[model samples]
Target: MTNLGTSLWLQPPRNSPIWQQLATTIQGLKPIFSDSENFEPHITLTSNISVNTQGQVDFVLDRAVAAAKCVPQGFQIHLSSVKYGSRFFKKVYLQVEPTPELLSLARICREDFVYMPEAMSQARNYQAMSAEERQKIDTQVGQRAAEWTRNEYDPHVSLVYSDLYPVEDADRRTIETRLEDTFGSGYDESGLGWKNGRFALVRCEGPVDEWEVLGVRDF
Candidate 1:
């Protein structure tokens, strides 16, 4: 847990056509960017779950099982757009539509796993502050763990991690264009814009290539 900690992910079924196309797209993009890493495509449900002990690992796995059971099996997630961002993990990804099912699953995952001590400490301090003082602090901080816990459930299936590349806005635009041309603009016309998939608990620490799946369950 010293690194970025663990995450729960919704991974496309490996045998599906959508998975094949996404894997191909990710591999094809690697040669175009310098020092890019290959990674399994997944939409993070909830992240930054610190698991520093065997007991915590077991707790996370058990929670993942309980969360998966709360949702539908073989759920479908549709793509909204091919986008890029400055964050290393979100350099290039397919933005997923914020469907009710997706949002519900994210909430469930967060309720189960994201118990950061920073959030707890901040909550106690905020309770002692006046309304005006709390608002001032919130304005200064912009977004904190509590805000993220409530509303920041952005789902994306990353296709490339090009943090080492000198990627410009134009490069991102070009990549987006090429991806849309290849994958059909996130509308499922090319049969690659959606996934019937399962959820997994992943050890997403250190290097992206080193991330490991601890468990996977249908829905």
Candidate 2:
């Protein structure tokens, strides 16, 4: 989009079967929200890094690659639960169970891309926390994340996009109903399984086609 430094990543390779199942669920549920793009399995760590110019965007990615090279390339995390993120925006999402690796990586990215209050305000709708608030959440999340070793992770994928105003309960119910009808029925689950791998830096904002990869980072 218009914002700089916006990118998507997956920490580890997800099981094809589990991922497929999730994808199917997302596809079936897409109509409930604004159907823009097809769903792909990913855990979006950070989004919308503001860079006024293309050069700035490239610089950030280059630095991110260098910074990420120091860490190993893979880590295991559990997909724990499907929860509704109502605070930031009304949306249903799969929550990744907090892991030390995930938290560490997230913190590093946040620190590296720390922005001014104006920029921070722009990300409010995306993440409920402001830069200051995120620090606190990150600290607590980090502690809990560190304790996740053998435990199964709770990663909840969103099924619906909650809007500022939920027009009709029936409309919401209908969407949920459609998802259940499509996914609840026994469909071939292709991409649903255990996932562990590295995070790739797909693209940084520039010209849509002329984007740069920030390089993949291992957890």
Best by lDDT: 1
- Candidate 1: tens digits of C-alpha lDDT, residues 16-116: 77777777888888876786788777888877776667677667666665655565454567876677677777777887877766776676566546643
Instruction: Assess each prediction's global lDDT (C-alpha) against the native.
Output: 0.69, 0.51
Lowest summed lDDT window (length 10), candidate 2: 185-194
Every candidate's CA RMSD: 6.5, 9.9
TM-score of 2: 0.49
Per-candidate TM-scores read 0.71, 0.49
Weakest lDDT window of 10 consecutive positions for candidate 1: 140-149
Alpha-carbon runs more than 4 Å astray in model 2: 1-5, 11-15, 33-37, 50-74, 87-90, 113-156, 162-193, 202-219
Badly placed stretches (over 4 Å) of model 1 are 52-74, 116-150, 164-166, 169-174, 185-192
Task: Encode model 2's per-residue lDDT on 117-192: one tens digit a residue.
Answer: 2344555553766778777655654544344323423334444533434335765667556544644532223222
